[model samples]
Target: MIKELLEAKETDSFDELCVRLGNFLGIGKAVPPKVLLRAIDDPPFADNLIVCRNTPGFLQSLFDDPKTAQYDGDAGKKKEDGKSNTELIAKAATAFLKWGKAGFSTVDEATLERRENACLACPNLSEPKNKLQKLVAVKLDKERVGRRTGDKTCKICGCNVARKIKLPGESCPDSHPAIEGMTRWNEPQRVAAAVAE
Candidate 1:
């Protein structure tokens, strides 16, 4: 489904496709599956919708060992470019989680420190207990946070889904630098995380 969406992105008529799908099925929601089904249930792309299954154990190691999950997809890129993937997630997480860490003046320093912390902590970054004290500590007036990450709502459960934040988008309170090679979870991860709740 995601791969198909990626293909749909390349089409000359994706705008029309999205519109047709939206019109036939629905528009935007918290997850993408519903919109996909809506596209399928209605006219146009429904019949042609393709589904691919995540191979069993394809990501088993990740689940078995989250330490590898946090591993940067592009370490060499970070070394050369001076940034790693998850820079945004780091920034947002830092912003969301900043408590008492210091030495963020340089990208190298922040990256090194955050990487070390994540490695040492090795906790699910999303867990409330693991969440930055700043985010939890701060008295936010807003109850449910409304974040903007491109994704769709689930059809099976009708729940909004989102992926984890990428580390590159993170910025140090002292120095806002790009984390290299990190990809912000487009939407699926966010949706997946939400569904876990």
Candidate 2:
């Protein structure tokens, strides 16, 4: 469904795409056309659209009531507690500091895929909860190295998983659930230290 919509983007007008999306989601009259168009064009919302296609009823919920959309799709799934705005800011600041320390260099393709795969399998991956977080997610989405459909924000560290995985300096906030001492995307030294500890 999302692939069809993306292909439609090549041939459909802005208004046409909005109507198609609304009709596809079965909420043609519920959401305004402009809002639907915005969702198609905006990164955070667009990503949600992709997610919605994969998870039934999510698109409707996202369009109907964005406030609860975060919880709607994963009602039965186990999710970690989300960070507060203050905590999110602190984490982002720390991540930037680490990135700066490493000269903002990106990891090689193999390393990037390894990190992204880890995030894809992690349960902490989640959707943007608010407009501010959506905006931040958009910026990070642009820097993404891999274009996987499962890409989303990391609930633990409040970074977009797709983008964070590519940064050489960034490390996973939590250890891999099955890997004992292994952090998902830690630098080699950090991994060694974690294993030692």
Candidate 3:
């Protein structure tokens, strides 16, 4: 059914296709899937939406993993990036000290999956964490359950792929240094616009 939705032609309305896809996925009516789909500017974004929707069953498998299910809270351990714990700690402390006026940033599921998929394909991304586990005050099962990662962190942004992508208006800053507003998720659209201009 999702595949059918993906196969929809340009003539097909994204809204109608999403309602059908959402129905098949059993996505609840609280937030219409069409609303989510509208955040997607293009088809690749739509493809990512289908791929990364975290169904309950999928989340269960992540929580079942021993390495991910429990929160070790070992922030000082040597990360795969080989930066010293002390150095990373200093960097974190500096950021914390400077942090101010943070606002909640939200994006529909489609945008996040699309950005994450881009990070997954980026060469600058070295070692990626298999999953994300964090402590939550509420202790709900779903909250405790870890979410799988497409990539752990971005070398360019010095932030985790999942976290960085979720920021309200962030773009990938790959090495080129002049990729202006180009993120891994929207490179094609950016290129098309550049060509047109």
Which candidate has the top score in TM-score? Answer: 2
Worst 10 residues of 3 by lDDT: 94-103
Off-target runs (Cα >4 Å) in candidate 1 are 9-11, 17-197
Model 2, position 197, has a per-residue lDDT of 21
Which of the two, 1 or 2, has more TM-score?
A: 2
Query: What's the CA error at residue 91 for candidate 2, in Å?
Result: 15
Each model's backbone clash number: 36, 0, 0
- Per-residue alpha-carbon lDDT of model 2 for 1-197, expressed as tens digits? 22323334333443455455554444543345434433422434443443344344655555555533433323301121454434433432332233223333578999887887777777888986654345434333434547562337888766666656665656778876556656865433265453222
lDDT of 3 by residue, 85-190 (tens): 3443343232222111111335677776667666656777654333422211112232221123433555654445555566553456663334556556664323
For model 1 the local lDDT of residue 38 reads: 31
Best by lDDT: 2
Candidate 3, 145: how far from true, in Å?
A: 13
Clashes of 1: 36
Global Cα lDDT for candidate 2: 0.49
Model 2 alpha-carbon drift over 4 Å, by segment? 1-99, 138-145, 149-151, 186-197
Write down the lDDT that model 3 would get. Answer: 0.39
Residue 179 alpha-carbon offset, candidate 2, angstroms: 2.5
- Each prediction's RMSD over C-alphas, in Å, is 20.7, 14.9, 18.5
lDDT of 1 by residue, 59-79 (tens): 222122332223223432333
